[model samples]
Target chain A: MPSIRLVDVTKRFGDITALDRVNLEIEDGEYVCVLGPTGSGKTTLLRLIAGVIKPTEGEIYIDGEPASRIPPQERNAAYLPQQYALFPHMRVIDNVAFGPMAKGLSREEAYEISKRMLEMTRLAWRMNSYPHELSGGMQQRLALARALASGAELLLLDEPLGALDARLRVELRYRLRELVKDEGLTAIHVTHDQEEAMAISDRIVVLRDGRIQQEGRPIEVYREPNSIFVANFVGGANFLEGFVHRRLNGSSIIQLRGGLRVRVLDTRFNLGERVVVAIREEATGIVPSSLKSKGGRGNLLPGRVRDISFLGSVVVYEVELVNGEVLNSKVPIQMDHGRFRVGDEVLLSLNPEHLRVYPYPPIGLYRELEAV
Target chain B: MPSVRLVNVTKRYGEITAVEGINLEVEDGEYLCIIGPSGCGKTTLIKCISGIIEPTEGEIYIDGELMNGVPIQERGVGYVFQEIALFPHMDVYDNVSYGPRVKGWDASRMRRLVDEMLNMMALRDRMHDYPMELSGGARQKAAVARALSSGSLLLLLDEPLGALDVKVRIALRRELRRMVKELGLTAIHVTHDQEEAMAISDRIAVMRAGRIVEVGTPQDLYLNPRRLFTANFVGEANFMVGEVAGSSGGEVEVRVNGEPIYSVRSSLLSSGDVLDGGRVVAAIRPEFVVMEGTDGMNSGFGGLTDGCGASWGGRVRSEAFLGSMVRYEVEADNGVLVAVKLPSLSVGSGFRVGSRVTLTFPPRHVLLYPYPPEGLERAISIE
Candidate 1:
């Protein structure tokens, strides 16, 4: 197993700096996902680690050895790009077996390894088929199987599962993690999907504008994002602009426009300090307006449902507060839960513990939330 | 107003059938989404509706008029594609006005129409910006405005949001649907994303193997699909092969892995043709699988426990946190891996990996279907 360490790495092209003083470390056999928006320089970081491109500044060490000048072929890192390539002349089985065979294994041993890898990828039935005969999804799976069979100590994958169907993607994520762990291989996967990154990664590195915004375990990042951009980019959250009005025991009351107020379990800000309260849609709850009379929660905002979208596992309700601020609350579907329709009066329940408080951005809320 | 009708439409390119014997009706002012895997003829069907390619057999009608020999320009239909190709040199205003200008319309009318299109697309502020300066979502909105400026009552969109970022795509799809509904235009959206189709369309049509498998409202298609292909395509379902054991009072018992599992008898199964010992399939959504922590010791299968349906013992193999929900893969005693999804708010439910648990599938939630003529693997395969 091999660990990777980058110290103050910076990559520049022409007048543009793709990476700015990036420092990161990957433990042996750990799965780390790099997630960001489109122009966030995710691909550039992957390329720098794979040795496809050299960093303009700082050093990269593989297992404590400076490897900035190492050629890609000599790095022994398997890189899988978005558009994967396969040997068109070789059958699926032969293509996968080529990796192990190149490592001096016998034909029988290589074929056995290839078969196991193909089975894990759900491509065992098509082992004898050529790459030309398979669909785009099948070909993508074949490429992934070949990558696993290569026996590389480190794997660099860029959107490896983007081409497969949603169902198959979920199934393969488990298999991919299991295979990586079983082989004790270190992997760094780059993706634009937040849910995929959250589901598969042991740790997530949130990158924005070629800079690391936050890095932590999935739950920690989701529950407590450090910045407004990280809060919005990783698992979208609803934002309410307010000012800290009063401080209590481990809590503060935030004053909003139109005389509305909400309590959050944070008192770090001074009184009258402008702040923004961010709550995940999943953290918000909804009930009938009639329930306001039998109210239980303290942070209840009465609103009218503007829209409802059924997303299979959960239904998202867009509520327009009386003050004209729209907030979304995602409720999980269950047989017992009451369903709300568009144009219905409802009460949105916000738990103080689930609300996150942040200082107002100097650049304004809209600019801070922009991915670019 | 225009409503499209296709009867036995077939398109063939020298023995390779792109679409075969398709029949569909799109009502006036209705939004219909055609969803299927790639290479499943979704694009071909949409192209036929747009009059880009003529059907080899059968008939196509628009607004009660035959359209077989009509040219695309004369069809009075708007088309938006996955790739946005606005005029590079022209600003947004000129690009949107190009449609009305080419129709020989006067300057006054063209200007008014372009303004309305720009306002509806929320692109009026950016009308002076060139294509290179606009974001991907804005550029797509401009293209849509250009398509709608021609006053076409029928809109055909093929993967219009496929090229944008995930967040932008989600936001734009809602805007597109709202605009189409606001204009009262009949729309046919073709996409490969199931959640997008479910959220934005009035109804969804599932196509496969050059043919339409099933069509229904999003709720109907998701909750109660009439075909096996529709269930597998529209959402995630856990399917188990079984043999019919008995039936009574709108319920059936199926023997799977030598265990009797109860399910609700579907109308197809209650047609009096299915008898005992017949091969069938039972499916349940992961959300319906109720799981609770067990004591790890011997536990007998029970018929009734806290209102939970048929109960079985299992050990959690893995768990994943997917934003709003938690998904667990549990390996049962009989070696069947079952997927169960629960809300993430249940943080202390204690069904961790390797924890013994009891899984219950409510009878009402279990759906019964006749086994397909092909094998189960091929039946659910996307390609």
Candidate 2:
């Protein structure tokens, strides 16, 4: 039996619908990351699974049995908020032991479990320190240790490292993932950070406006995003608005605005259907101006460089087409930095295989276009 | 003329020394960024330079004149704080015009200056909107315009985009750099984001513990970091402990554990300088390490065999997909884990965990640093 399961769950807050008929299954010892933007129902989904907030109309099952009657404390799950929320008056060791002690464990047992957890989190040296004396990262680790010491089968973390500095965040992400995997615990983490979700989760469920946008492995979601929003939000994408003109063998020719034609690998749409072709900036490359006259086969556009940004590891160039559409191209920073500048005309070639196409909903049609 | 200069500047608050004995020079129209972690004194340094706070010791000069005696208004410097302090009661036009008005400029001149500043900041369309009505990014741009309306030669920005979202931060960073460059304004921007500082600044000054640790162009800093802190802070690095085994011909072999690895030529250390077979830490960048099959036929560096040039064998322990690249954590024969970043396209399929792989780092990419700085472990522990 799976550790936790939610079937046809829908949550509504008055006139505002937060989650709409969402179904999810988390297996035993699986580390699942619930990823989405702010106010996108990620927290709500976690809350529902944790039994903190009852679903509006659905059944939540644990070990193949309905758990609707179970309260949060008896649900056998741990939920860690964005803030560590440790007791300000308690010392680090006491805070971690609180959960185990509340579960009726003896003082000796609770102390042993808390000490082991704290040691694993690298906070054993600071166990006697109060919450106020601990650093942000240390406090987060203490909260994690407390959650683990609670002896829950499932752990739910809401933006666990959101309050940490970049360096500390990076370090804690690896440590957190290691702890979860080593302890063989099922975890459902909620975060808006795409990189953090991708780095740590076995599978990611990207939520948007109370609905699941896409759920898959990090590579699957990144390489083949299901929608425009997924492509743009997962990393970053340069979107080109176009209509499908023809479907060739395994490839489709897209006719963009301003009479530009692009060959894309996606053939899910019929001819004459408007679609948006999205490509990651790193997938595009720049060629010399002289190469424009060579009559490239497909996926090549003539553009003038609008701006160039040197970002140590990579260089992002903004190129403006004759029709005024802007496209971004990223190259390795080791390449000649001065090779391209603002106002320089260049040819940009996009790999057809890397292009993702989604149906371009008409403007003023619905809010769905921007929701992805 | 030099745009700004600070000589042995120091600042203190009670027992805390925010900035200590800092010296820096910014050229005319140059964009310099001060980057560090929080409490690293980046903001204090910027404040001292912008005349927001007087340095406890040392002098600040702008265009070859002492700026200590001159008030902030007469220092000919523009300052933009992290928070957008626009006058909420006034319209955009009036707020932008306030700087010129306070400097005793006539109404006609102030109007012309405000109009030009608004147009330059791309706020001409919303000149009548109140401060609360503008977007976060737009408000920051307007604040910048207000600073520039008085024709200040130097601009100081303290965590200007610290509160914006990721997308807006990226867009505004490019726009901010362009606006500063287009107007030929010298800028000193303080930020905690290393990438942002690298993306916008012509030069960067990395600070740590109230001192400037390193100063160089972004490329220079990334390619050749002089200090251990700079190497780890600027980007990802794999530090491996090795020893100088021997030198054959022009190549130097550094034996790590039982496996021998070759390093690039270094004139800083001689045969006598290194204790025979003494250990050192080799810092290698993940980008430089190529998978065995990915490089194909060219397995050895510069056509040298016997692992003399640049090669190391490791077993892949874990791998993570980072959108553009796949980062692999490999446990080398030396038992040290090294991370190697390969372009996603280069590896047809991602490397599976526990796959034995041989990695190669080009000679130019490997940096050699002593195993732990002299007397630093004690100092770090004391804090």
What are the per-model DockQ values?
0.51, 0.44
What does candidate 1's lDDT look like per residue over A180-264, in tens digits?
9778899999989898998898899999888899999887888889988888988888999999899999889999878889988
lDDT for predicted candidate 1 compared with the true structure? 0.86
* Candidate No. with top TM-score: 1
Model 2 chain B: lowest-lDDT 10 consecutive positions: B374-383
Clashes of 1: 0
TM-score of 1: 0.95
Choose the strongest candidate by DockQ.
1
lDDT of 2 by residue, B161-262 (tens): 876666667778888898888888999999877888888999999898899989999887887887666777777777667788776565556777777666
Candidate 2 structure, TM-score to reference:
0.89
Kindly report the docking quality category of candidate 1. Answer: medium
**Whole-model lDDT, model 2:** 0.79
Q: Judge candidate 1 at residue B221 and give its lDDT.
A: 83
